[model samples]
Target: MESSLLTCKKKISKKCHVPRIGTSLSHFEPKKRLIVGTKPNIPDLNLELPSDSEEEEKDASDDVPKLLNELEVEIFARVSCFEYWKLQFLNKQFSQLLKSGEIFKVKRERELVKPYVLMLTSGNSRWTMVDKSFKNFRRLPEVPSDICFLYCDKETISAGTQLIVVGKEVESIVVWRYELELHKWTKGPSMITPRVMYGSASHGTDAFFAGGIKFVEKGIPKVCTEAEKYNANTKTWTMICEMHKRRKFCSGCFLRGKIYVIGGRYENGKNLTCGESYDEVKNSWTLIPNMLKDITFKSSQSPPLIAVVNDNLYLLETSSNELRVYDVNENAWKRQGVVPVKANEASGWGVAFKSIGDRLLVIGASPLPRSFIKRMAVYTCRPSPYVEEQVWEETENCYDGVELSNFIHNCCVMFA
Candidate 1:
């Protein structure tokens, strides 16, 4: 196991500080919580870079003799070290700086040179503005029907490009698009396959689906492990890495442009301790280590929340209240914090939580004072972000009728 990256989280006595807009010095405190979403959290959609070398990290520090007859500076909001490229859309200084390639500023010493615009993603769920600082969290509403699988919609752009895509899933899979700027969900292209209890991971516009059951195998309860892919640019489907084992309720995530799959229930048993990673470039699935738990992810009620921070992969073991981080390069596992309020009977059951950004937000149908109110909870929990990530809602899409129950002249037809 790689001990370097797999150590336990170091809790700070107090928060770190990142200076505000006018400050010249560089200081940053990580966010308080990972944003919550409708269903199972999906992949970390944006850039996941290891800390670069000191020399390479400082490569862009030299001041350019302020160019004469200079191009006007384009203003951007506080976009992180990544997603700085969407600046290309702007005609003025935005285009020039994007071409300059000087803003890959990894150094905390150098504060943001360019600004950023945050696109809030939305679905059927509504936003409950918490406060001014977090922008205010958007709360997820109850699904009219039972959930199958949840996916956080994501897109790819040139490294520094900023494009926010959001869509919560429904019982049925339907073509949908989320306008981050508008903070709304609308229909988009339909999927060729309608899969429930399956998870989707992506690189840019390219997305891949893995391990979900199409139907309950009537008398013989069997789960499906079929893996599929979709290309947003092409608007088509292509199958990719088939997991070493078949599983349902499996969770998939994309980190460093690769797919890292973990903790799913299969027909053979509840949890598949083993891990799988598919390299898009290589077009393959190499089994890593199986989870140490003698019993892994058993009876997963929802797709697991999976994310990567500092290249170490982490996930919320749905059935169990604890979180686990698997360091692929190091071949080791480390246990993390417990989900807050997991013990209370009221706090337990019928809960939904997924990782968004650096935080983990949870929503559960809770029994409240006088009446049962569906409450939402947010926590600035876990270690460094393994990667930029978002939560997804479980919904139905392209798949047609799950089963056919009809009558023939002299016979009965039942599809399962």
Candidate 2:
């Protein structure tokens, strides 16, 4: 029997794309204003003649200042990413200004861009996204049917507004790219080799995939050593240098322009303590020291989820719900605080972590007395040697039919 038992497996597995409404800022497209013609192309609407006073009021509303001053622009740049998308929809001038990169520049200069954690989980071919606040959510379009049942050992990365997801169905692997600006999901170049439980990381518009099981031969699945990268602009995959060792269920992050693959598991069922860093420019993989040799982890514990914040890598443990910061200067992992919510006893299989702005977003399922519930929370980790107590503030919860099982295969961070 498969580990994941789906309630809608028979009905959904054979179906294809089903359109759904969702939120994505998408690229700047000129809004098509309503045209009032006697014979309209879209004839379904009941067009009525407007009164003279109504027309005059509409003109006055349009005459309201369509542009913002320097100070006003600065103030508007502080709006949250979600609100910014909605504002653009209301005014074409706002859309044009936002697309010009002027607002992002001013925000960067003023240091006002706040990061909000975006959480995603899927079951029965439906993908749902929610922010840390839980007050806002967007139901993404239905996932592709080919890999709809392929729900375990998945990986995700964010390149700008695009969310890249890699997962496998049987021996074949599929790559799905979700465009935040366009609110669309498009297929990308699949890996040359099929694999599961691989490590992935993204920098800019490119992504790297490494170290997973290719396929089962002679009743045993072989761990992979070859690595590949995906170029978002070209929508193609390129082979990269092989790693020094084989790894699966590993944690990865792109820091300082280099790809780092941390601890994973081998075929023998023993966890790997060593790690490796891949230098894309150098076209070589450098073996990193055994950072986990001194640390202790349970037998069932998978590798921690890694996220880059201010050029430093942080790890979020699923077993203990603890956060650790890696100091490259000191070559040690500093103990941080624990997440406010506890994870399900399944060794944190449903938990995920991502670094948004200066805070860390942890999303997962917390085991209750008779059931499990979903939670989205944020925590602040300071850089100073001495820091204050950190708490995970719960923003969202699930009380409906949303499954609390290992539905969330992976989570990632993307800058809007």
TM-score of every candidate relative to the true structure: 0.49, 0.67
Residue-level lDDT tens digits of model 2 in 195-252: 7688888876688889988776664678888899877656778899999989888878
Off by over 4 Å in 2: 1-116, 122-124, 131-134, 147-153, 216-220, 366-385, 388-391, 396-407
Best by lDDT: 2
Each model's RMSD to truth, in Å? 20.4, 15.4
Sliding window of 10 residues with minimal summed lDDT for model 2: 23-32
For residues 50-116, what per-residue lDDT tens digits would candidate 1 score against the true structure? 4654223221212122321121221232343233324355345545654443333222124443222
CA shift of 68, model 1, Å = 18
Give candidate 1's error at residue 296 in angstroms: 5.2
